[model samples]
Target chain A: MNASTSQDRFCEELTALLPRLRRFARGLARDPADADDLCQQTVERALKSRQSWQDGTRLDAWVYRIMRNQWIDEVRARTRRSQTFTHEEEGANIGAPGDLAAENLVELGNVGRALARLPEEQREAVILVLVEGFAYKEAAEIIGVPQGTLTSRLGRGREALLRELGEIA
Target chain B: MTVSDDEFTAYVDGELTGAEAQRVAAAIAGDPALASRLEAQQRLRALLRGHLDPVAVEPVPESLTQMIAAAAAEDAERDMTDTKQHEPARVLDFAAARARRDDQVRAARPPRLTLPRWWGTGAAIAASLVLGLFFGMRVADDGASVTSGGALVASGMLAKGLDEKLASANEPGKLRILTSFRREDGNYCRVYDAGASSGIACKDAQGWILQRTVANGAPERGAYRQAGSAAGELMAAAQTMAIGEPLDAAQERAARREKWNK
Candidate 1:
């Protein structure tokens, strides 16, 4: 097939996966706008390195890897600028609590805030496994951790999340 | 026998297999404490999903779909360019080299000019032809466009501005054309940044149709992208609207002379 045909097919496949991509993005960035921006950047990066994406590998995992990297870079840049020194400060940057309250969606708003308060790695692990429902192996590969490491991070992340929600000991 | 945290975590994830999984399941059923721990893990997973999963189903913003489409267009252009550069070499070495070798063995016989297999497939020729058409629509330049009342209609100066303005040299005027191109529908489209607002316009039978406009606000010298100040955003919309690349100066001039092919 010609390049155009190949690219069109590739894009069609990728576009079908956008909703899941947005969900993962929302998990990473509490703010809706930021999540969309992150999704945009991920698509751009994946398209640029189209050849580097091996066929037969899961495209969702590849795109997730790109998004995770992009989010990490953004966080580091924000930190260097001292824009958000703590995770709570990061949640503040999202500025959704007031809006959530206005809409009477306080439970969701609190859950989102609590998720954001987890350390970055823990949050990533938890989001991939819990929110996105990637299998353990696939989640490990996307997060670039060994199976054991992924499970450990997930354990810590879930523990923290439950504690923050005041659900259990 | 008590399970370690790793085992418990793995069990929660369903990683344990065969007898081990069975063992964990039986243990949980027998021990209230173990069952409660398992329940907490499952609840936490469900709660997280309950909170954020709504974003998955919510209508994806138009900007995101546009962005993804724009990126795909770009990747196609890059791939076409790469193929154009390398395809000929492979053809010459494989087909031409074999033909030359055959001619040498036949002494004084004329060499058969055999085109590459892909040449017969018509992909290379089709690829080149499509490149110009694709890149014309794919490459991003500058400006943005939005509809005023959900439709892209324009008249008076906006149409006149597109017909006369040269993107290369900005005129100190209200409406400046950042770039122009032909849409796939054979209509002409222009992206314009008009001081406080930027938008895209396409020429139809009626005249320039305003596709989209962003209220960029007062052009601040230094600040976060004020509303839709990013001309690239407008250009992206133009690309989606366009059939091919923004016309070069020569093409633009010819287009103007023809009054945008109207």
Candidate 2:
């Protein structure tokens, strides 16, 4: 590792973001395999574009931007294929959540389960703002939405998640 | 003051400040329903964070992390004069495909040369360790590989390791398969560590052709790799020759079935 290089520093911080990246991916994709695949793409994209990232800026927002863009691309691709490709948990992923193998790894909490089942837009808002602790403006920027639109999605997502978790409880 | 749900959402998210925040504070204090709604968003935030924070801490797959570090490190290590010709960035750009190798493989310079049986199969230590020197297809009278018109051809144990060993099946033996990948033109290649030395070989035509060799010089292993390790240098060579991600065990097994053609 080039300890003194700025690239090294960038990667170090990027490595630190893995957990939250994984969590955000899981939230957005709603499938463990997809989440990991998303996470891998995000890291790859982030690294490839490491030069474009301005110094003294928040790496989290930059990475989240790359992640959501890749995911949006994936979601768009899946939407197109939804009619023809029966797209069950992709062919090679070991286990999707709720599968016995994944269940054995960690028995997911009820709130986590409810969050996973939320609608895509709402899930994105919830994960960015609530789960990732990003401010509304930052979350909006990451999602490429206006603050007003972001708040609306957050409100709807929050209400649905509350209702869903209430049932799970 | 009846705070709209959007205003309440912003307030809960800590985005509403000063007058609007104060207004929400007063409303929540006076109305149990408002207070409960406020508490619900806060609870959800906590719940969501609680649920997701653990994933960030979970062991990041080594491949993902290493990809970033090694790519950057190699980018720094590469000589400026090497090649200005650039290939498009690919997610599968995991091989050490230097331009020369790509050109050599593309032109199909020579008919496939057969490796001599005298090259010695099985766990033979690479009799020499030429660390830090890229002896381009430098053939030995009695070596694991020989060059035919500058392209390194794998013979002996190196050839056997490239043919049979899989990195996924990491058994401690004399031959250690580090990784396998395909080049841009679609030939399969592998990096290996055998006793004292390691090198990379790409399967061209009908057999494993050694592309480059150094004394255990495989770079770009992972970012955590110590700088200038001979093992890393070998991988660095492999990286320039590859335009695809390393073959996982299944892909490697599949490649083997096809004898690594194309």
Candidate 3:
């Protein structure tokens, strides 16, 4: 395929992936508005830099990596401005109405809240692995960490989350 | 021996191979606590998936698709235009000529004294004299009626230009405006951009001072039509004057509470 044609196909594929991307973004960003904004920014950056993509590779991994970088960039900008939001503050606005099962919704809300409590690295690992269903190697690649480190983060993150949600003794 | 949390996670993720998985299963089967812990991990995974599954199934917004399509179209146009402007042979010839010129200059003898250094010194003195003449003319023009010191002193057309023309907010695509009541270290800061450059200025006992300047891409000219143009420049000049770190969130909030009166 010509470069433009290939880029068009990539856009089509990315369009199909948007809902899942939004879910991953929502998982990371507790506020729905911020989550949508994050997803939009990621998609925009990906589309603008489509030349960087290699053919026959996993498109999902490429998109996720872009999203992760966008999130980190935003975090850095916010830090430069000295802005911070606590987990409680972040969670206060996220529970959507009438769309999800109540128990499941509450669990999701708790998970979102729990996610905010995690250190940045652990949260990223958990999001990529359990939430986004990336394989360990893919998750590690996306986060730019070793596979062993990713697993360790996931292990610690799950334990901490369980404790926070009162799921542990 | 019982399996650890990490081992259970590995097994659940299928990271453990043949014997390792079997050993973990055996341990789980034999140990009630281990079995419960394993179940808890399984439940957590299911819980997480259950909540996230709806999001996965949620329809992609139409607006996002449209935006990406538009961006792709724009990129294609840009690439086509670039290709038309630079034929391969012409580009190679241009590079070759530029390389020859550079080689000639390198081979040329150095002047007895460097022309740039001599010119730079002369230019510096001339610049100071011009500044003095301009200000002197201004004083004479105003009949010495206006004292050229303090906040009011920095309130003329030049000051206005410094405030309005030097900001990034006046730039086209990458306009940014920052306003802080007080920096984290307790100084006021404002940053703005114009065209290809952005600058930060700070306020102190000395007056508004320029701090840092950075040049990015060319800013949009259309931004000048906005009411914010002058304000943008003032903020840019303020950023140039900043001292210490820009205000932290808490300090900025406090400064805002005071209405930036300082």
Candidate 4:
């Protein structure tokens, strides 16, 4: 394919990857707005660095790596401040109408709260392996960690998550 | 022998293989405690997935899809630089000629530098100027719009064009104004035919926030009247966002006189 066509194909494929990428971002950011911002920034960087991405390799992994780095390097600190500025005050305003809706809210709340309690490292490890369904090694490479480190992080994260779920249940 | 927590976690993730996996399997089968731990591990994964996966099903924000469209439009334009539209091998050869013609050719070409039309409010100009001064990447002269305080704000000449130009004026600049109308929420929105892309920006509290920009399949250079698929899409978007027919020359001129105030 020509360069432009190839790039167009890349963008097309990248567009297809958005929904899953947003889910992974939500796992990392724990805030919906910040997660969306993270997704947009990731797509932007992915386009800018399109030449760098290997064609046959996994686009999801490559984009996830960009997002993980973008989060760690830049977005995390900035969004954390804004999340408090807007979302925290705005959070209590979310109204659940009935018992079932309230129950569902608490269930989601339990998951988010549980994920929040873990350190960022452990949180990502758990999200990558368990929630997003990456293998130990693939998740490791995406997060720029060794396989052993990822396994240990996942183990500890798994333990913590289990305890949190048990307490809430 | 007891499997370590890592081994157990890996087992739950099904990451283990061959004899190592067999050993973990054997251990879990023999050890009641290990079996329960494995079940708990499996349960945690299921729980997290149940609550979190729904986010994937939620509708994606239009901003994101638009950002992708904008990026695609950007690539289409950068790839455009010329009119003949060659095949792959020739496109590269053409790249060499393009490189000879202008220093900024190919992907290395910088973000937008000229204004076909608009300038920001003085404060908007000052904010982006200071922003450009420090950030370096968010340059002013090249781009018609730049992000300010996390929001998209029309910058430089484009902002000036948006504030003053009327569609009914009938003269075309490098960037042609497609239409100007009030949106459903009463914001004054203007569409511009920007070569490879068609963009619409609405005047807002932060200046003109580029509401939508979609890439036309190819840049016709000066063919403003011809509606390509991208133009069709951009017009459809404008149609959806607009409250009524686009303003006439008199209306546009008057809106300009009032400084586009709602």
Per-residue alpha-carbon lDDT of model 1 for B47-74, expressed as tens digits?
Answer: 7888888888898778767866987767
Cα error, candidate 2, residue B199 (Å): 26
Q: What is the overall TM-score of model 3 with all chains considered together?
A: 0.50
- lDDT string for model 2 (B48-147, tens) is 7777777777787888878877876655544211121232442133134334334433343223321111111010011121221222222222223322
Sort the predicted structures by DockQ, highest score first: 4, 1, 2, 3
Off by over 4 Å in 2: A1-5, A85-109, A167-169, B78-262
lDDT of model 4 at position A123: 84
Q: What tens-digit string does per-residue lDDT give for candidate 4 at B1-262?
A: 8898767766778888999999999999999999877777777878888868999999988877887888788777656432233435476765565454334211222243221111112112222222222223211233233222345677887788788776655355555576777898898998765544557889987888887775443323332222233344455567677775566554677788888878
TM-score, prediction 2: 0.52
Q: Over the full model, what C-alpha lDDT does candidate 2 score relative to the true structure?
A: 0.65
Displacement of residue A102 (Cα, Å) in model 2 is 14
Comparing 1 with 4 on TM-score, the higher-scoring candidate is 1
- Candidate 4 wrongly placed segments (more than 4 Å): A74-108, A167-169, B1-4, B80-262
**Tens digits of per-residue lDDT for model 3, B113-219:** 11111111112222232222222221111111112223432234323444333221222333333443345456655543323344454556655555554432223
Q: lDDT tens string, model 3, A86-167? A: 3655534433211233454455467655666677778788878877878899999998888999988998988797888655
Fnat values, one per model, are 0.68, 0.69, 0.54, 0.65
Which one wins on TM-score? 1
Winner on lDDT between 2 and 3 is 2
TM-score of chain B of 1: 0.42
